[model samples]
Target: MNAKIVDQHVECYVRSLLPEHTGLLKVLEQFAKLHNVPIIHPEIAQYMSVLLEIAKPTRILEIGTAIGYSASVFASHMKRGHIDTIELNAIMAEKARETFEDLNKSVPEVSLSIHLGDAKDVIKTLEGPYDMIFIDAAKGHYQTFFETAYDLLSKNGIIVSDNVLYKGMVATDDYIVKRKITIVKRMRKYLEFITTHPNLETTVLTMGDGLAISYKKGILNE
Candidate 1:
């Protein structure tokens, strides 16, 4: 992310840098770091930007809104849509509010709303039809998030899940007993179930800690 100051600094300083920029990208990143917002890696954020641009979803439901860095990225690329972000951490929710307040005044093209509660519970209150769903919250709740996303997404919609690899821990032997093994294994199981499902077609790509993209066809949920 040498192209962007946020990338360079977050990498050098926090080591959890994500692909972002200024003008718009930087403004959000600054607020995130300023509030100690836990954001995604730079490379992943860049990739996510492209994904959002390509999909251009009218309604996007983001499971996690840590300081709003990624949400900002999506907001910047979403030419005509708004973002619905869920942040369970009160500190993070408050930080994201600051970031949104700053953006709402300057960047009028995008609007952001926050759901303050657990993603799964908050998701139930949401009435659907989100064209895009981003699952990036707790590592252990991936499976449940999948089920919820399926129920919320519109027809021919797409869902993106992050951090499936957990820093390559999923590949280790079972006997090793990794701290996050159970969750990681469950994530893998969820991935397999989604990829093999008849209604949804999924392709897990090896991009920046692994991202699983699932595309759902038609409306079959009852």
Candidate 2:
């Protein structure tokens, strides 16, 4: 099944135009491709790099740390910051640790820590006023993750949810497979909540897969 939410040709063209990934990011991209590990799309990574530059977040909380690819991206872009990333699988967490260790050598200013546990459980244990929260974990549990992490966000913080379109499945019933029905439904509900909540102002972009960027509204002007 083609799990791309964007049109294949358009995605390909956009990716082709992106500057080549270098150093650790290049290596990790190759590794993810060869090993069939899921990481953020190159386009998403590029977009995130721009977002990081503009936001200049000092503290970031990442819900998924697969091979630490996205977390590495976040770390590299920051001049000085700390990242707390959660990975559910122990092996993946260990792998992420190695990635962070290497990243430290090159980008020593940013601190990256991998917390090994279910995101739902680990998020509760965190004391945070994070400048940004990036969610790219289990598809079905996004709402739970968002709700659980809401209090941890800093006043002007943003939450970026990835793969919300779920390969276009969440956009319509036509793309949903039988086994993914529950996930699609949940994703729809999550989207609805984020879009309509009075405390949030969200913009859903049909970029890589999909990205729902929600800003905490109550304190932005103050």
Candidate 3:
């Protein structure tokens, strides 16, 4: 399952350099692995936190709240920010809510709101001008998510899409299999659109799976 730019040893070495997390995050990470829930890699989460620090986004919208790990990361990094995370699975949503509550005990200033429902439907109801939008949900619907999230993005906003490389399959057909062809094709198409879109300046980092960071063009001069 490790189809990334860095080899396993290098990845491990890099991760070793990161500070240890002894909080609920460590517990969540362990639980997610045991249950096979796809959570962002620790290095990826660290990168996201760095992005949050630089952007200093006050309002963040996360499309997937899978147990609230990334949401918690975002909240902890931002000095002042509110997160609105969506999760389709009720059980996962409940667990994420609990995690947020637990995290709140320490960082009471960070605000996190969980929306339980299909992200597509939830996207329709959101009236947002969020400073940052993090998409880590259904890989197949990334294009739709980006389209819906575009209108909600504030000026100078940033959109971060995780798992864009799809295990390096999107870059080349060598790793492709019959069952995953559809997702690979869709992810490739999504990458093409984001990279070539007239209004977006997108860069795909060959990190965990891959992370696509897109900035709405023309926001800097304004």
- Candidate 1 global lDDT: 0.77
TM-scores, all models, native as reference: 0.83, 0.96, 0.95
User: Model 2: how far is 89 from its true place, Å?
Assistant: 0.4
For model 1, the superposed segments whose C-alpha errors exceed 4 Å read: 1-20, 27-37, 174-177, 219-222
Compose the digit string of candidate 2's lDDT tens values, residues 12-61: 99999998879998999998999899999889999999999999999999
Q: Rank the candidate models, highest lDDT first.
A: 2, 3, 1
Off by over 4 Å in 2: 1-3, 219-222
- Model 3: how far is 64 from its true place, Å? 0.9
- Clash pairs, candidate 3, are none
Tens digit of per-residue lDDT, candidate 1, span 1-222? 012223345446544454436665677667556766667766678777788878888789999998877887787777777789999989888878888887776667888999999998888888888999998999888888878767788888999888766555554554324465678688778777878888888888665566788889774565
Ranking by TM-score: 2, 3, 1
Better of 2 and 3 by TM-score: 2
Q: Once superposed on the true structure, which residue ranges of model 3 sit more than 4 Å away at CA?
A: 219-222
Best by TM-score, which number?
Answer: 2
